[model samples]
Target: MVSFQQESDGDPASKPWYELGSAKHQGTEVTMARILQEQYPSHSLVLAHDVLYTTYTRFSILSMPGVEVELVSKPDLVVNNSFKALPRSAFVGTPGGDNVSAELVPSVEYGGFKLTWKDRHFLLYIVHFARGLSTNTQFFLLHDGPEEPSHQLLLAAGSYQNELHDEIWQFVDGFWQKSSGLWKDIQSANWDDIILESDFKAAVKKDVYGFFESRDMYKRFKIPWRRGIIMHGPPGNGKTISVKAIMKDCSVMGYTPLYVKTFKNFRGDEYAIQAIFDKARDTAPSVIVLEDLDSHITEQNRSYFLNQIDGIGGNNGILVLGTTNHFERLDPALSTRPSRFDRKFLFDDPDRPSRRLYVKYWQDQLAGSEDISFPEALAEEIADSTGKFSFAYLKEVFVSSLVSLLKEREEGHDVSFARCVREEIATLRKQLDKPQGPEVARNSQLAMVH
Candidate 1:
């Protein structure tokens, strides 16, 4: 609603049209003024909230490309130019009155961004200063009642001249620039990347080649090409190491591996969570690694998660992969469909062949120049003797042996292979026999295996 008050100069009822008090409205009167402006063809200017005056003037000039912005801070200043002409004394300050209250027109106040325009149809680019996700620029069409205007009208809006702060704009702009760059980084990442351990090299070649063949067949048959894999095992197994090695191998083939630790709060915030899916959609052919899956996204949360994933709508290009120590804890609904996690493989504790290879792997990594070389025969013996030792424990054994060998060499004595092997074996034996209580041991032995 627009409220109009009558005003008169001392000259009778108003001498002439130029000297008469023109139609004036308050800050909240713009929407109504816009409506009136659309109906009438004679109104030259439509005034809005005083906060938008500066923005309107600046934007109106810049959006035209070849126009210049002229500031008339005081209300009585006249403006004239070759390209655009605004009244030099157009901007009006309060006409003070003895009976009028002091609160009427002292100053302008604003909380959000302010903008303005010259013509009935003018563009506004507002920069709302904020604290969070840093949305710097906004382009909006502030039309007069969403229709064609019957006349031209000057629409002025902006904050007070002295209150124009550049620091806030700079902060918003800086954050916007940095935040936008993450999209470019995400776009540059590759999907289809997998890494395999040196021992699994042959199996990986056959597995991946066959994996691609199945994928091709799915596409040929117009099937949803999604695959899930379950890599489950005891703690300290090669599950993590195998994933890392696979990442390294996949990097060679231009796969960009993104590791997501699926804890309680995987998504940062609502916007950030949406952004992850947005980036996924934008940057397809990528691998998303959900690590440590059991702690979060299980049971009840899993259903909620499936709902969210379905809502994402365009996720076919992403290759979903995951790792977990407790596979049974995962929701059965995840693997209910055959192709969901089509390739489930166990990364059990090292068997004999794996143990022998792991021993060589670590020995080659830590052995000194004059140190006793890795004994394949000894490794075979250790592999045969230590049935419960995992690859991680073997790596620890190799490190301990190297330290022992270095100490013996410092003592100026020939290191004995038997002594080193004995020390490593003793450590392994202790780890193997470290007692859980009788009850816990019994439960561990009978724990359900999935």
Candidate 2:
């Protein structure tokens, strides 16, 4: 059995030597494997290493059933020469709520721990080395048993991570990470709450639902079972909410939603695009939401993005739903191409009736509030006064009005909520009359060019 010794002395000569610095020059796995073999001569070593952000192997092992992990108190060998710990933050209550708490994850940077699984002893070392600008984490397992058990342990840990529940896979920083808060945010996004024209709403639903349900239909027609839909218009006109509703619906239909926040990462946009679609293909029959599609698909990565959309690797059962506020900025290959983004839905500024419906939706929300008297008729008045306003601007008006009303109450002065809302609307309307910014000017130029 491997016996424990005193912790590493300050002297570099006395301390154990590891090829950590040379990891950048050589294969990290090979270096770690060599170190493990030298340190644990009696036992066989199994090594698993990946970029720190890509996997949850440690957490998966911790949460595994009948598995116990104990940190090695006294280690004869300490590679990287220092002990480190960092806190893992978590929301205590509701996600995005005020309550946040963090727990110290011991020895995450570099430490040794013993894992007990199935009444067998296995020594494990969790170490991280800086690889260029990123950190590469290595998991070294030493056991006397046949390699199959250790291999099974690693495989089970990975499989546990792939089985996600109440989580949405998000592509950020060139990796696909899981975000439960995003899933929670979309839970309340139902189709009934979305205020679009009846026919328009139905069409959007059919576009998404029909594609997922008609996999066999696509096969019958001898076409690829992949689809792309673009939602484009001015900012904050039901585009985001509609996408969320679709995400929720897709989850209900047993399809995963993979949200891509941006394509800009350390490796470059090309790498990000490849990683995003790779995950989408792996989790086939999934929804890939490219929010702000115009910003993500630029001249640099346009061809790569198009190829991935209708690429040789056959994106079967994958649906790409892209949203953009600046439709004019999108390339013709993306906006007009047939198989790339097959359909484009314009979420233009709400018409008079749609605006009225939105106001009524807000009115109903405030009906039970004693402080805000948002009567049914007030909805019509506000909608009539707010012309050429996006849903976002209207929301700001309502929010600012309510805040002002609260301030008035706090100051021992009473004011009518209706008057406050009307004043705020007038204020926003004046702001809207101001000249457009340079970005808008550029978009207009591009629109003319297109």
Candidate 3:
């Protein structure tokens, strides 16, 4: 047994053996080495990185998570650089203080680890394990030292076979909490529950994921792999929930959600933005969510924010999704420029059909709740009284109505409370929807001047 990268200059790129995986690759040589050392703790194990050619590469056609994105490998050897493993166990110091157990082993960076298994004549085991946490296992093997592809072979790792990596983050107290830090348990209301406009869903499908799948077109057109979306319109609409749904859907395609609570959370606003984008780009094909775009990306720090997104060699595979109540107030750079936020989907008041469906969605949810009666005609009655409310408003309407009905039920009042709840919701909507009076606008201007 010997160390593959035993007597080499620190320069890994100099080698002509093989190429490296994309930045998206998970496992590294250090990880493989750790596992190898643990498996044969007593035995002096030879450590080497395997170069996976076409033939030796493994293909996992069927698995729990079928056809995973891992450095695949099988039991095979390359022709040119023949590997000769000695049965005798020994250790000797090599150059750069990295002691080798045998003679020359393959030199690699972030690839699979090759080591002798049993007999002297036994061929090398080139394992390229898919390195991730999930029930859908890869038996992830390794390859190059720190800059190459790998395959899953040889070593039999135990419980690590089932690892689940939760990739949702939050910015809290000036630092970005990595995936494990924040609320990993995400419960998104069923897509059927949220009443979204027709065009909104269609455009999002074509704009975001379509853009993602069509990466070849981007390469041909020489465009960056980043998309920005502005989900605007009323406050209570399905903006926030819709964003969560996007995150859940995008996760299937490997787009982790990174939440920016507020610029105020950052110790320094400027560095915070840089850190956010840096992490986003580091783990590309990620979703950077700014729930309140106008509030966070204000006029004061908008310039710095713009520079972060518009920097040279702009973000690749980073989808910057922003939800703004005040769409017009958002910096023009975010909306005016096509590249910055290519799409703007409004969560306007739900139309008649949408409102009816929204109530039906609630009815389906409340079907089992025997506390109150979600009568058949109640859906239309509520929709008629609400007068074109947003998803959020409709939600509030049902919540308030349900609460009122519950109170009536406790008091042994008639179920007719639904009508009162409906009337009250209509009245509440009118007050919230009132156009800004002249005094309010004038005072806003005066406050700004000060």
Candidate 4:
């Protein structure tokens, strides 16, 4: 594959080597060069004084301009410092739904730039000078090659980059599973939508928004531009909703969302932690949403998981937002450590005022309904009656109430929406106070997480 054009200036043993890529290699020489021009560079640096240079003889007749070149190591760059290598082949279809014939050789990661002059379809790896002098800096070029290429390299680098940006994955068992489209569903609630303790809301707002704005501050402090947050409490309260709000808010600010369903999804792979951390690094400023964080970390992989957070490979701009119903189940090292889950937010069951606010929220949601509307006084009364109700139970009161009305309407009886709403609240209180069925226990469990 090496075509020695001539001795690399003054270094006789270090000859400038060129290769004419065929159907077998990374695109045709020209095709690879074209693709390389669009590659999101992995790292960029300047070549200063005392760097090597190999000038091509064909361009010797032209004015000896200062040689310049560009190098891109990754297929995509989602955000700043968010760059990574692509795989050699893909079983998944491209965004365009076409058969993607991309062969992104993970090993063949050298930056490239195109050569332009005299209609010559070729790739020339020239060098340039920048920054200050250093022995580590290097530059070189290959001159000799066939005038044309056999075929274009089918490296769908562009497509591959696009796919990862739009969708993320969990390597559960052998297949990739898509979970938590939280970003898209953020429209369901905003800061004004959820009813939480005011101080809690203020703190959450400040941390989430302030973190993104203070990235430079993080750098100045020589700290990683990353944050860890834990939302814990009984299920059916507001942990998941808060997490979604964070997801939506972060998305508006242009951070990518990463969802990890559980630790067991990795299925005991030695490299799972590394791979997970690597993906987050490649997509910096990403919100890693890990549901049930407490149960995911067992004694077996706890140490390994901890290493990834503060390890040498820890990435900047990563916001680790985890939600857990059981705080007692989590390790103190994970929940208490400032470097791991720095801040913990408790989503407790609704208090009296919160219960009242919950009723108001439902009223706001149903304001446009034509058939019936719950009055402001009635709403407050409903809130008073449901003092101990979680947001989940409050939601069910309305839903079950509507179902009862539907049944009455179907049976040709007059539907009294107000009566049904009030009755459903009383019925729910009794049912919750005295639970018996195994199915109800399972449903209660589901409601808590819901």
RMSD in Å for all candidates: 17.5, 6.5, 16.7, 14.1
For all predicted structures, in order, the TM-scores are 0.50, 0.81, 0.57, 0.60
lDDT of 2: 0.77
lDDT of 4 by residue, 1-450 (tens): 322232233222112212322124432334433433343132122221121221111222112232232222123111223234434454457789976454342211123343333433223333221222311222222333431230111112112323433334443442333434433455586778777766767877787778878999998999878888887877788777777777766666777666766455334743556556776787677777788887667888888888887756766888877888888888888877888877777777676666777777788888997776578878877877775577888889989988998899889988777889889988888977834222211111111221
Better of 1 and 2 by lDDT: 2
Which order, best to worst by TM-score? 2, 4, 3, 1
Instruction: List candidate 4 segments past 4 Å from native.
Output: 1-171, 174-189, 265-270, 434-450
Best-performing candidate as measured by TM-score: 2
Error of 4 at 384 (Å): 1.4
Q: Highest lDDT: give the candidate number.
A: 2
How does each model score on lDDT?
0.44, 0.77, 0.57, 0.57
Model 3 CA deviation exceeding 4 Å by range: 1-164, 179-185, 265-267, 311-313, 366-377, 430-450
Rate residue 166 of model 3 by lDDT.
65
lDDT pick, better of 1 and 4: 4
Model 1, position 336, has a per-residue lDDT of 46
List ranges where model 1 is wrong by over 4 Å.
1-129, 132-216, 249-252, 263-275, 308-312, 362-368, 411-414, 434-450
The runs of at least 3 residues in candidate 2 whose Cα sits more than 4 Å from the true structure, single-residue gaps closed, are 1-42, 51-60, 63-65, 74-107, 131-134, 370-372, 434-450
lDDT of 2 by residue, 1-450 (tens): 434343355222113334465334567567566776776677788887764556444446656777887766444334443443323454365465655454334435566677888777787776666666667777778887678888988888877778777988888877788888899899988888887777788888898999999989899999999998988888878889999999888887789899999898888998988888888889889999999988888888888888889866679999999998898888888877768888888887676777888888888888799878887788888877777788888889889998999999899997999989989987998888933222221211011111
